[model samples]
Target chain A: MFEKYFVFSPYFWLVLFFFIPLAIIFKISISVSEWGMPPYQDIFLFDNGFKINTTFENYVYIFSDYYYIGSFVNSLILALISTFFCLLIGFPLAFYIATSNIRLRNILLVLVVIPFWSSFLLRVYAWKIILQNNGILNVILLNLGITSEPLQLLYNQYAVIMGIVYTYLPLMILPLYGYLNKFDLNLIEASKDLGLNRFKTFFKVILPLSVPGIVAGSLLVFIPVVGEFIIPEMLGGSDRLYYGKILWEEFFVNRNWPGASALAFSGIIILVLPIVIFQILYSRWSQKNEI
Target chain B: MKSSLIKSTVIFLGLFFLYFPILVLIFYSFNENKRVMVWKGFSLRWYNELFNNEQIIEAFIISIKIAALSATFATILGVMIGYSLVRIRKIPFKSFYIFLSSTPLVLPELILGLSMLLFFISLNNVIGFPSSRGQLTIFISHVTFCIAFVAIIIQARLTDFNKNIEEAAMDLGYNYTKVLYKITLPIILPSIIAGWLLAFTISLDDLVVASFTTGPGANTLPIVVFSKVRLGLSPEVNALSAILMFALIIIGLFYFYFNKKFKH
Candidate 1:
């Protein structure tokens, strides 16, 4: 009954609006490319029209070139560094928020999440202003007699890391909050009662229990940060480039459709591999814990 | 005791880091001079100019229209998908379908934007509808991704939902549609509203997707601010940011107030 309605009713309008465009795009992509098949496919539809042999040319090009490889490294370094910083800052904050007075918890959560409602672009742009040579930070520093001249805070790697951590810190905090909320206070008390110090108890008990949330939050931040364009683009400036910026340049600047597609597919694969593996490990661990 | 003091200090520093830029933007919006960094006497000249600025005003209106329309469409679709997934049984590949649908939530905005742009161009070439890409395409793109997020949130709420009441209503001879309208809809209305608000904010906050999908003469507020910032910091931009920030804070406060008041 539902299938018949799905076929005949106006619901198809939604499906068509959402799905058909993608299908048609895929169709055209196959037709327009000289390969006459997707680049990943091994066989051509027609023998004479175009060649279709699967090759690692795209990956080779991306990895072999200094610019592309440099961007990839830059992306990895930035994502890892920012993820580390977010974890370092977010763990304690999450713990505090989770264990704080019940009355204050909701208000604090709201405070952390309220900034998300503002335009992400605006937030990043605000950071650009704050970090610029003649920006507020520099003005404050000059007035305080800390520096002889304005500091170069903007258009650098540090600014990019700061921008990323600022945007993604909430992603880390929310999950850690979720994990820490379910934490049994009795376990910590028992550990303290057994003569383990607070720090050791936290490191051994609380941290182990919260591993799932940490993994979830880290993946959430790291995956998106790998493909992030705007923060790095605005803060990193022209001199610095990342994989995301490279992909953007390929599509918009070069208008090289095949190259862009290749880069996108590869980038997605590279970034998602670790996440998929992590999820698999997490699920296995969860299953073990459940049993 | 010393450790607790350190923890408090760390939390305070984090809060300061999160809010410092916003405070600066708010303060500078009232600065008398055009120089954004320098301490100038307080004035509302920039705020007045922001209100008077034609481009900023038009962009703001356009953004609102897009956000409202897209959020409404996304919410309706999201609620449907959420309800269907929860209510249906023996559905094939449910997990895979859910994962595929929710992938947009994790995918980078740049890739999504680029892929959608490519998809729209090919769509125009093939079907010839939406003969020109502009506001319509942008709204569609926003709705596509926003629906995924809305669905995820609503689905979480629906999974915890009790269905025996609905079953009893159905056993009493109400049709499925009637049962949904009379029973399920009322119960899930809060989640629906929450989903709508989420979609609204996502659409409003979008810049990358909108930048790629929006065409000539259809620049949104973020695009305008981004371009202006690329040139240099302006008090007008700060004024605009301050206004946007104020609006969001008001909406958030209103949401919290209503949520608490209506809970009982």
Candidate 2:
């Protein structure tokens, strides 16, 4: 009887707040837009008796417009590049940390992830200080005579990618470390003993084994980066658009409630629904292994 | 020799890349110059100004209040979800339930924030109780998402917990509630604390969600900071970053300590 409370309490909260909110997003996405307060017509109407009003036009609008689709494409490309760079930088670090003696592993792992504790806005702000024309990086480059003039580096896609890689590195590293730490270090030794060189051993043995970690880490970084707003907003200039920025503008700047809802619901279908399914299945697998 | 040197160098470089920007942020915080990038004689100049700034101080207090309240709510609800998932066998639509609890973990904050804002508006249209968006709206949104984070931690901790203790307690004739309070609760207390701390940090650090849900007089520290530095930079923010980062990093350490302690 008491266990029912434990189950139902969170269930009720999630349903009312989480599940219903998502349904509401779907509801508004399909609702007809109008020029009034709340901006979208209610699904049910009683003007004459009863009527249902909803449209797929928001979907059509978002799909047909290149601006919306292009921003989404930009976001996908950005997420891919960011995830790749994160894997490149994070792999060796995670592998090395996982290989560290047990005593040092925890400390190194904690140190690497501690940055996540601080304000994300501030961490991105730190980059602004570094990339400014008069900032330390430029100062050093100028003093070294690397460039005759201070290079403009503050806002652009490159800066956006750099910021994403820097911030999301830990998300990549943590999962990789989790996966890497579980495998036997002796596997490497065994591969070497079989007359395999370092490259072959790594590719044949280590790489194949760490795919779960790589996928987990990449998804962890990739999914969020696809809808990332802050990094691009602060570090990125007006060179490109992203899904996050567009969704933000549609509602806040452009005041298109139904349109924004459509974008969000579409985002759920496009970027989120698949990942959520995979995560559910993955968690089940992990729990079974845990038991 | 070459291998060991290479290993140490890569590790060193990785740490440097991670810590350098933070060090620079802190290093510049103490500069007396109004220009943030230019280094000058060291002083507590920005820190003093930060303390004097009414807007930031108020925002800090508000952020703390919301974080604390929402964290408490999230912890309670999270503990329940964690316990239910691990112990209860008869949950209907178990996969759907699991999906609900975990989707927030990966869903983009931008979409989450928009969904939440839309929900609030529709709720107000039908109910009209909230009247307008403010701390309450932010609090609800915070608790909703924070629950997922707390649930995950609590779930991981509970799964690793020794089931024998609960069994022994049940064998000794204690009721379910008594066993939970006396044994399970005590055992998982550290993780509950850890969950709370993680939730607290998340609420505090959130910028995107808070921005979406925020309204008049509800500007969180992140929202305020973003408004100031979104297009350009703010020197006061540099100082605030140093202070806030130090404070939050300590909280992070505590979270790690408590969460990690139970893995033993």
Model 1 chain A is weakest, by summed lDDT over 10 consecutive residues, at: A3-12
> What lDDT tens digits, residue by residue, belong to model 1 across residues A1-291?
452331222234344544454443333333333433222232355667887644455556666889988988889888999999999999988888887777887788778767766667778878977887888788889999999899999888899999999988888988999899888878988999999998899899999999988988898899889899888878886667898989889767766555666677666567764565554466457546966
CAPRI quality of model 2: high
TM-score of each: 0.89, 0.98
lDDT of 2 at A285: 95
lDDT of 2 by residue, A1-291 (tens): 889999999999999989999999999999999888878888899999999988999999999999999999999999999999999999999999998898898999999999988888899989988999888988899999999899999899999998989998999999999999999999999999999999999899999999999999999999999999999999998999999999999998888888999999999999888888887888789778976
Q: Rate the local accuracy (lDDT) of all candidates.
A: 0.76, 0.92
Please provide TM-scores computed only on chain A for all of the candidate models, following their numbering. Answer: 0.81, 0.96
lDDT of 1 by residue, B1-264 (tens): 996798679778878878887887787788899888776799999989999999999998899999999999888777766765566554444444454455567777776787777777766755886676788989988988897887777677777678798999999999877887899888877777777877887888888899889987778887888888865688899888888988877666654553344234
